[model samples]
Target: MSSKTVKLLLVGIGGYGHFYIDGIEALADQVELVAIVDPFPAQALDWPTLQAQDIPCFDTLDAFLATGITVDLAVLASPISFHADQSCALMEAGVHVLCEKPIAATIPEVERMREVRDSTGKFLEIGYQWSFSEAVQNLKTDILSGHYGMAQCLSTHVAWPRTSAYYARNSWAGKIHNAQGAPVYDSPVANATAHFLHNMLFVLGETQQSSALPRKIRAECYRVNPIENYDTACLEVETEKGDRILFYTTHAADANDGPSFLYRFEGAEIRYEIGGDIVAYLADGSIKNYGNPEGTHMRKLDVCVAKVLDADGATTPICSIEAASSHTYCVNALQQIPVYTVDPAYLQVKEIKPGEQLTFIPNMGVHLREAFEQQKLFSEMNFPWATPMGAAVVVCPIHS
Candidate 1:
């Protein structure tokens, strides 16, 4: 660790890179930006800021590492295809990392990453922002403390609609694999509404640094958009202990709500919505509030920095790679199920303007809400358009 200040590396200066830039600037006093790794850095960062900071840009990670610049921490905002390679490379280069979510696209890549991190002795925290928030951490702490007794079942739903512009915003937004044949598995669950799904598995972990693995999962996928992957999904994952975790999410609906949850425990019921407080109401008439996960922007970055600087060697990033791999596990398992296309009868496209349009299914939100509330799949609700998951169960492998 750098005694005076942490030396940092920034990767991918576009898209979500803007958020990292803001966080870096806010914590400028405690850290120094050592290098910027991006093919074209100016897309998100202005020339003025770069010139003032005197930061050098590299066309690739290989080029930057060749310079032998010592970096204590590296924040990866790169694409999904590059995460496995880039994270392993940085950790092997003696840098702790904060890589963005879904961990990687496949279980094999995730296993490879875990191996490298273990061998290199560097910590890698996946950028599941909500997991690092005080609210989630406190909730997880309580869950581990047995204050909630046993988790009976959990359900989460997110309905964030996306336009053509969103999928067109990047080359890999809806792709299952990148052009390089690397697994990306980009979809609503893997990318956009991922935090919520991952949160369900995260808080139910047996320990602080580990998440519960899904022993079995059954899923149904559908796509209304002309993309490589499904735009909507509903699935049920069962833990080894046989507790149910249900998730329903979509980007192909007209409604935009949620990231809300209903987590049932033996002792209490937990409920939360985005931009609102998290409440756990117990059977004994006691209630606890866990604030809101969105209360802090880039709070994950701040916590990682504090972990590096704190004399407390035991302190670590709240969201470790192992804890995040469960999401990847769920993702890979979902790949086995076929992605069914929605019938055009339910599809409608509203042109926002020339060269822009929003596509959605009529009354899709209502169907999704019913499934989520009932902790049932669309097929179980007997929707005519829905298809059964049909014994498409997959068990996430326990690496141990």
Candidate 2:
């Protein structure tokens, strides 16, 4: 750590990069934007912002590193497939990193990154912002303190629809692999709703364990859109302690009304509505609502900046790479199982406009909510369209 301000590099100036830019600007007094590395900066929707800010840009990470510039930190908002190589390379060059989540596409990649971070003795944090929420952290504390008693189950349901334009937004939007043959696994669970998945893991285990490692995963993935990965997914995970975790999410629905989660314990229930509200149901039938205010994403960046500037390391990041490995492992395991498409007879598609359509399963939100409330798998509810995940089970090893 230095007495002077830290120099930060913004990598992949795309959709998510905008958040990092805003975050960096918010903490301008402690950090300076030295440069940006975007493989295709010209195509970035936020490229004009970078240009207007007078920040120099390079077309590749190698090109930026070649300049012999020294940045104290790198904020990676690149595609998932590129995370491991880029993070390790930057860290090897003596740069600390804050990478976007689902930390990597595979377990081995995350392991490799951990190895590099160990050898280089640099800090690497993953951008799972939900873990940094005060209320969420409080819930974790309560669970660990036995205020919630023994945990019984966890369930998550996110049903926000995506149009053709959404999937067409990028080359890796719905891909399993990028043009370079690197695994992307850019499905809903791996990318968009990854925070919720990671949050479930975080709440289940202490920050040291980070996530409750899944011993087996049974998933029924469906592709309504013509993409390499599933647009909709229903997953069941059995942890080492035999507690089950259920997840249901889709980008082929009606509206952005979800990613709601329910964490049921023997003594209480913690409920979270993505972009909405959070509430805890006590065993005594009392309702405790933990309002969901905004700004956690930006707050996380500020925390990272503070940690970088702190010589004694007093401020620590809520979500680090080691804590996010369980998420990466589950994602890797799910991607290995081939995705199944919903039968056309069960799907209802309506064209909203030219090159855009809303595809959904009728009463999807209702069904998903039911499953969550009951702590049941969608298939177990006996929906005619529900596909059994038993055959698709992929058993993954613990990160230890």
Error of 2 at 109 (Å): 0.5
For model 2, where is the 10-residue window of minimal lDDT? 311-320
TM-score of each: 0.95, 0.93
- Choose the strongest candidate by lDDT: 1
Worst 10 residues of 1 by lDDT: 391-400
lDDT of 1 by residue, 1-400 (tens): 5466889999987888779888998988898988999887666655468757789889999999999999999999999999999999999998889998878888778889989988987888989988888888899999999999999999998899999999898788899888877788899999989998899999998888778888888888989899999999999999877789999999978878888899999999999987898899999999999998898869989888987787475235478776999998888888878899888887899887789888988877888889888888877898776765443667665532
Candidate 1 vs. true structure, TM-score: 0.95
lDDT per residue, candidate 2, 130-195, as tens digits?
777677777777778888788888888888888888888878889988888988888888989888
Best by TM-score: 1
- Model 1, which residues run further than 4 Å from truth? 1-3, 45-48, 311-317, 388-391, 397-400
> Candidate 1 lDDT (Cα, whole model)?
0.86
